[model samples]
Target: MSTAHNAFPSQSATGAERGALRGALRGARAYWEMQKRCAIIAGSVNVLMLVVFHIAGLDALALFSVGSIAAYALAWLCLQRRHNRLAIGLMCAETVTHAGFGFLLAGPESGSHYYLLLFFPALFLGSSPRRAMLPAAAVLAAYVALDAWVYAFGPMALISPFDQALMRHFNSAIIIGMLSYLAIYYRKRVVSSERQLRAWAGSDPLTGLANRRHMDATIRALDADRRGGELAVLMADIDHFKSINDRFGHEGGDMVLRRVAEVIQGCVRDTDHVARWGGEEFLIILSATPLHQAAETAERIRRAVERIAFDELSCEGAPLRVTLTLGVAERAGQEALQATIRKADEYLYAGKHGGRNRVCRHADDPGRRALRQG
Candidate 1:
């Protein structure tokens, strides 16, 4: 079996699920980007707060802002050196400490609790969901402790009602902005990962052709559309593929498959669909084509395969040669898609048995008639 089959299973149900899982969980690299953004935004916000508090003559709050700025600056340095864990620790500690000071000095009316809420989503940006749980629990414990402290004692300092409302609004805006950034970035990562996973699922890894499952879906979709156009199927097999594998081993066989697939693709138009059906066999769908035209195409493909020189592959000092036998069948009006494909497969084997490196169409086909007479 080709490595392609092992890489993407022909089973549709399992493949879809596996693809989704791989896509969803593959955002570890994006985490660092999120971390950097968070650090810059946090550091900037605290710098602004430092100026604002100093102007308002709140010396203690201004001092806390300096500490927040230093923490975030260190976090940025840690990130530069790729010390991600230390950076995350510094940022989390700074955020919790800042929120604690805000509530102690200016009270819960200042909406400092909103700052603490950032931890839930921020922690999830680190690595896997399971690993994020410990930090998430720690944040939860801190939140509960902060709430208990507020219940036991009130604010130690007082500020104007207008000042309290402004701080509340400012903190609310910051949390909202940060959360929105995380959401958008997370979505982009998931979407890109899913697209890549889907491509892998539908493609043959070795030849980069549509795999069997994807081809089957394409056929079914055409059947459902019921557009009044005739489509033709060509089932082609590499001539003496097993012998080639036996002579040159699986690696050489894989190379031949990829080369033949490229030749077949070159012979067909972009509108046509081609897939590595399985093993050494390929299936092609020629849209709006008649049986005779498809047969001509198959013959062209056969000639192209014959022309491919495996200069690097040799057995007993003779360079390797390759050829293909193809079967052509046109879909009848209202005929089942599978029935047409089966007919193509039958013709393909007929071509193989009658003589190799031939294109077999309907019995009345002139080339097929000549083959029988010879």
Candidate 2:
């Protein structure tokens, strides 16, 4: 449990709010994953630079590179442990070390000042915007002081002309490469966020099924396409749901709803769509299915729901049983979706009044009456 839980409550008031939170978390996690990737890449690059500097006979640079490697390694370890703040601190230390080395090697004259640009992306990636501000300011101030010192007094070690030119090119290359990576990573994150936002807008948070809005949109789309054979709609209501909630708390009610959703989804075909219409009620849209077949599917769902013991969810040792009444209706000619749903709803009410745990379809009404008489 964390802030995510508070933002994404188990019992959300509206589907839109729940969907928005899910989308936000998806976007946030993607950015976090990118930051972790950046840390690993930075660590590997530091190790490679350490070896290169060591071979080039640059003692001071090599020693600083060794410290940089250690700092990045520790940062990486912290990330593995899920200690993001510690990893950010280590990355800051690594940045400072890199600046110090820049001063010791060739200072401002060799374009070592360009290395400061690296801190911007690294700091932003590793920390939140509010938290990154202070560290970014401090790093910038330190780099400015170092640059002023180098300009006023000159570099400590007098490196050869060839080494100065090489250092300048190398530092420039690193900055360009890092900038390229940041641009691509940010772009990809934006795209992913947009996609998740769309999905959340259409999805129900509790059961991960299509929300009412999405279902409506889908039905409208299907209705527009008249080429389809036939469509059947089933309206299902859990029986004695309030009593279940009364006996077992709201948490238990939530669990039962989720279980019912799963059972209905498992009973339906892949082409069929299931949605949580509202509290304790679900709607199923079966493509190319007639009323009779849809009734069979509803019966299957009813049986599956009845079989659920809900042992884990029960407060007492006794097992809990839940039942549902389903009504099936098929779309006729160019009939409106809402009209068909109304027909289904009428049948569902009839079944609920007659007896719970039964499937009622237009064709089965007479047979049910005869059976009752017999």
User: Which residue pairs collide in model 2, if any?
Assistant: none
**Over 4 Å off, model 1:** 1-25, 47-81, 124-133, 147-153, 365-374
Candidate 1's TM-score: 0.82
Q: 263, model 1: CA deviation in Å?
A: 2.9
* lDDT of candidate 1 over 1-374, digit per residue (tens): 12233223443455566666765556655787778878988989988788776765667988999889888889988988999889988998888888888877777888877888898877665657999898789887887887778778877677888878877888898889889988998898879876897798888777889988799999899899878498999999888787787877777887888899999999999999999998888999999898888888999999999999898898668779998888899999899888999988877767766777888887664545555666
lDDT of 2 by residue, 23-91 (tens): 777666776676677677776766766665565556777777777777777877887888988987777
Question: Which candidate gets the maximum lDDT versus the true structure?
Answer: 1
lDDT of residue 144 for candidate 2: 80
Once all C-alphas are superposed, what RMSD does model 2 give against the true structure? 5.6
Per-candidate Cα lDDT values, in order, are: 0.82, 0.77
Question: Hey, what RMSD does candidate 1 come out at?
Answer: 4.1
Per candidate, the number of residue pairs that clash is 0, 0
